[model samples]
Target: MPLRLPPLPALRFFEAAGRHQSFKLAAAELNVTPSAISHGIVGLEQALGVELFVREPRGISLTASGADYLSYVSEAFSLIAIGTQRLPNHRADRPIALSCAPTFASRWLLPRLAGFRARWPNVNVSVDTSHRQVGFPVDGFDFAIRLSRAPVAGTAWTRLFGERFVPVCSPAYLETLRDGHGNADLRRATLIHVNAASEDWQAWLDATGIEGFDTTGGLRVDTIQLAFEAAGMGLGVALGRRPLVDPDLDRGALVEADPATIASTTAYWLVSAENGDRRPELADFKRWLVSEAEHLETHADASGQTVRAAVS
Candidate 1:
């Protein structure tokens, strides 16, 4: 049997009114007047031969038929939206959607992405930098790299690498410390704080079991990357992530404060929807990611030796 579909504009009007229970609000969203919205709904109800909504004194309510149809309408709209979003990717030569933390994207992922692109020249990568947790199926992301101690529930997760924390400062700042007689003299130096995670400084202090130094005295920034930059500019000493700061350390832009360090409770992870098992793109991206991660681990191990030697 052929499906008899209502006019799309009328269906859209009906759906919006049903959702908000207000013709005026629906009109605002649809960029039409309230009368236009109401007229459209009435026309739709007439076509369907059913009263879809009850006109209440204060507002409006859905009729039984309206409630039943509303469910189908909402689902239809959702599917339409999803389809619309996927259209561009479908036509593109290489389509991959990746989401990750902003700082991690800037510091770690961006540097290594060129390699991925070189290996898979046909793959088009779209990167989204957001702190919000992205859910699969609903979020429409193909894959994500996340920093956390535990995998997000209900997702396929792979540990990319562990992270460690170290105190870092610019060469100029280190010179100041050396001139002032060393890190133990940092009591008089400026400290940079990352406001997002208050425990970072405390964790380093606890790991080193260092006492008598005030960890809280300094300029506070929202992101680790910003703090790292501030430290590079000799603004203050920043608590740094080992992997993210490796380049700076190698360039002699920053120096480690101590040989002792603590493993971050949070580690970098590669994640995809459990249902993404069947997606060829997701599979290829995952395999590529694992290999890249292994390569990074090897590089970091070698870099750590140089950092230790330079500091010693």
Candidate 2:
């Protein structure tokens, strides 16, 4: 059933008058004559069968009934404005839809996303994880994080960071390894494969000239972080990607089982479609990402180790 209510236009004038306590002030705000404001309020009060305002020689003020009604009317108008805000013409801000790999999102990006929010609180960011590369101009993604050596054609590729390969193991597991040849002793250690198409463990092993290790036997996980955690728990030696393992290594959660490391061609790239940076928020995000990447690279360069990421 329709709500039993006074006329909306009259109610608007009444609320404005009630708030200002002066028909002249309400008329000035509403761009109407003072008489119109007074007439609208009078009609509203009549429709509600209540004297909503008390007029005086000096001015006018809302009665107790009007004050009570003003609260509900003002809230209703606020709700109406809120409901209208979702309309395309009314909304000034839209969420920056970002697509990225699950591992990269969780391990690297999510941890650092707080800084972005703190800086650009008004700009909304929505992240979705997908192993598959998003189709630009069709998928509707504003930005994407692609971990690959080659950039997707026709897209702007902003290099986030380069990746390297290392075999990471828990301190407890490293303690069990033979001292003379850590790489060769890894033959006895269990391998935690990330199950990525790149086969990081094998790539690292081949780079170090280590052979005859039983690569076939080990627990396999779908993502790098899961394998990292498994390795940290002393389950097995998992292949660690750059930056992702840096945190664990620094915290002593995991250690590089082999001193040798290989700088892979693969790296994390920020991919955007043509004209994707048209939005100011997107441009800021791109700049922020580049800044973060530069800082990471600089720190890694200072330490003589390089920045690195997602296995694509």
Candidate 3:
């Protein structure tokens, strides 16, 4: 007896189209044109005697059947990837590729990666700083660290830690905020704003119930790192997210302008495919990352300080 199956290429097209819900995107991922993807999917539908996608005026969507098929197809691909990595000839020292936002990569992960390297001398880690949504295996990344209010769908994820934002500035700038009566006055202080996090300053003000300060005037920078740098140079007060601002606070480069802190809805998440941990090196990396996050949380709990938010 022989197994009945559609052509492998057709299956690939169908899976990609269904996953992205866009023939254009599927074509891009497969390095083919939209017409080619459409033809391949039509061919697949004819072979299976069933339609996988529901064509719409604006775009395409997976039929209920298509969604069900995608689950199986995706799982099959994940298993193949795991099995291939487990083969005897597979390189055990293959580098672990990760995707994350630039601010996180620079302010937090990069500073701490040396510790991971010291622990696992054999495993090399590659980091790609991207704010775009990335797919696993398709993007050729072993894992991704995403900041989101909720877990990303269609992937396995672990919440690393939540974030809290506080206003930070140089010691001199902090002193400048004080009046002759030694009372804190923010009306005269410059507000340094990160363009990406434009609402942070206002959010902090609202959360702290601090009135009469105009958040409209500020020096706007594109990234949190740049904002922190500007604040360090005495440009203005930047709303600094904890863990990201821990190093600056520790080194005396930045200080909390106010003790009030506002919690962020978003948290850092470690994301990967279902079988991402099957590889020995990847499994070790996951364990180490989780352990590091736990250690940081534990240390923060015991410190009783708002500025020193995490592990030293």
The model with the greatest lDDT is 3
lDDT of candidate 2 vs native? 0.78
Candidate order, lDDT descending: 3, 2, 1
By TM-score, rank the candidates, best first. Answer: 3, 1, 2
lDDT of each: 0.77, 0.78, 0.83
Native-to-model Cα distance after best TM-score fit, residue 172 in candidate 2, in Å: 0.9
User: Residues 1-312, candidate 2, lDDT per residue (tens digit)?
Assistant: 977877888987887777778888778767899999888877877778899989999988778887898888876775564445435654357688899887788778888899999999888888998454454533456789887878877778988887777888999998887666643478788988877646477677666677888887889888887898899888988877777788899889999887667777677899986666766678899999899999988877787753233223
Highest-TM-score candidate:
3
Per-residue lDDT, model 1, residue 127, is: 91
Kindly report which residue pairs in candidate 3 clash with one another: none
TM-score of each: 0.68, 0.66, 0.74
After TM-score superposition, what is the CA distance of residue 47 in candidate 2 from its true location, in Å?
58
Q: State the weakest 10-residue window (summed lDDT) of model 3.
A: 303-312
TM-score, prediction 3: 0.74
Q: Which run of 10 residues does model 2 get worst, by summed lDDT?
A: 303-312
Better candidate number, 1 or 3, judged by lDDT? 3
lDDT string for model 1 (194-307, tens) is 888634777776666667778657898998888889999999788878788888888888888655666666778988766563546657778888988898888777765433
Q: What C-alpha lDDT, on a 0 to 100 scale, does residue 279 get in candidate 2? A: 60
- Clashing residue pairs in all predictions, respectively, total 0, 1, 0
Which ranges in model 2 have alpha carbons more than 4 Å from their true place? 1-91, 179-184, 306-312
lDDT-best of 1 and 2: 2
